[model samples]
Target: MRKLLQPILAVALGLALGLAVTWIAGESPWHVLKILEKGAFGSGYDFGMTLFYTTPLIFTGLSVAVAFHAGLFNIGAEGQLTVGALAAAVVGAVWSGLSAPLAPVVAVLAALLAGTIWGAIPGWLRARRGSHEVINTIMLNFIAAGLTSYVALYLLKNPDSQNPETRPIGPGYLIHQFGIFGGAPVSAALPLAILAAALVWVLLWRTSLGFEIRAVGQSEPAARAAGIDAGRIRIIAMCLAGGLAGLVGVGEVLGNAGKFKVGFSPEFGFIGIAVALLGRNQPAGILAAALLFGALHKGTADLDFETEHVTRELSLILQALVILSVSADGLWSWMKERRRPVIPETAGGVTC
Candidate 1:
């Protein structure tokens, strides 16, 4: 109950903060709240859009959560995702004539391989050179951005198009969009994301590798003393983390965009950190948190037009507040501890 209630309270606090901000800006908080609700769920189409936005968040959230279990911070999911998308696009474009089923399979494999390699570099550096994963991952993100941009602009750019994007993938590689909900761009990726979440849950709870990862996270010295290869486990965990994040590419390139766009991601990778934190790094919790964020993203789209003062930035503000509230739990607990009554010590130095 505490676990459930904590997240609920955090979300409530975030919403309240957003409402207060709205009121201060001279907007009717009630009207904005109603607009958010209507935009998110007024129609089936709106709901589908929410789900569509959620698919990639699920992948990125799981990626971060997996790394957290291994006591690693993978801030480079954005880089891994970018390279994975490029790989998928390259494979799909080059092998456009392949059989329908085989094309997507090959493209997905390319994405996984690319992401795994990108993620492994940081893991290897951490294990072999004792370099910090945080610094390495952050550096890799800039490299990936530049590399992908160069490729999109020169090698992959469609001849007749003005946008700095790759050529469209083969139709055979494209996941069919579900026309349910009035042709909202929801695709097969939603079910795939759910399956990925279930698979991650099983992997973490039912596997020896998972045990080793968790053990290393809890106490690396103890794991080393017990003859577990903590470094190897960390590297493996990082690879798996990257592979999961790479699936975001599959959703975007093959599932929705059909090409690798230069600026397709709106910091989905960074936002995933909040999702993982809010979910407490649990798969089930991550799914729920991702859905909430997805709804926020979809619902806030119309704020610019619907209200005079409110804008879509309110979503970011709300997300920031939630993250702050959840992350400050330790501070709150420490404050409570400071306020607790102290028992007097006896002459024997024992406290009553």
Candidate 2:
């Protein structure tokens, strides 16, 4: 429990710190709050958008969390997500004549496979050649950036449309709608995201495979001594992480756009690291963090609409602050000790 509390406390402290920074910058905290409220929860439309925005974040956050559990940093999630999206887009366009069920199934599978391959590159480099995943994944990001753009701009460009996107996907591959919520972009992916989270939790906590991964993550040498294949485990963990990130493409294409945009992702994979940190890498915490980010994404528009005084860029500043504070707990601990508030018992992990 102690593992979880410290991070939560750190975020709270960071939020206060962000507010202070905003104040010093001549912006009122109230203005910040107003912007958040306006963007996130103003109406059913806003709420729907919040859920919509959360789709990619949920999968991406789990991607990082899973890799972290294996003691590896899958910074290549951005590339994985992009490649997966590209794969899905291609499949979506090619299989347009098939039955809806088969078309979406193919597209989603292609996305997963592409993501797995993308993730495996870094994993393979790290395990076999002893290359740092951080370096390889960062490099992969550029490769994906170049490749995805090249294809989108040339090979996949829509023939008749002015937009830089591929041909429209089949209706079958599109995310199902509540229909009740008109044009909200809320799709069947919500339940899928939740299911993915549950599966991840069960895989990490209940399954023997999860135990193997965690054991390696806790300590590679100890895991090797216990007869576990550390390198294999790392590779598997990264593949699964890639698959999870690829699901983000499913959520975006099948659920939101129903087609692929060349440059759709605005660093959802990168932001996921912050979400995982805020949640302390726990499933419940990850969900909460995703929702918080979703709300922030949703509310920023409202915040800007209600009060044009502060730009949405300020929200980015706050996000960075929260991440810094959560990652650095000593500052929060000292402050908590100073305030003398009883720290609530939490699942605070020992590694911190």
TM-scores for all predictions: 0.94, 0.91
Give the runs in model 2 whose Cα sits over 4 Å from its true position.
1-4, 332-352
Provide the RMSD of all predictions against the true structure, rounded to 1 decimal.
3.5, 4.9
Q: Which RMSD does model 1 reach against the true structure? A: 3.5
- Tens-digit lDDT string for candidate 1 (1-352): 8888888888888899989999999998899999989888889899988888788889889989999999999898888889989999999888888767788889888998998989899999998899999999999989999999999999879887899999888889987788877777787778888998999989889988888999998899999999999999999989988888888888889888889999788777777888998999999999999999888888888899999999998989988998888888775675565697655554344322
Model 2, 1-352: lDDT tens per residue?
7777777777677678877766776778877776677668777887788888787888888999999999999787889999998889888877777667777788889999999999888888888899999999999989998998788778877787888887777787886776655578888777787888999999999999999999999999999999999999989999998988888888788877777787788778887898888887877788889888788766765544565456666567767888898887576566656687555563254225
Task: Give the runs in model 1 whose Cα sits over 4 Å from its true position.
Answer: 338-352
Q: Over the full model, what C-alpha lDDT does candidate 2 score relative to the true structure? A: 0.82
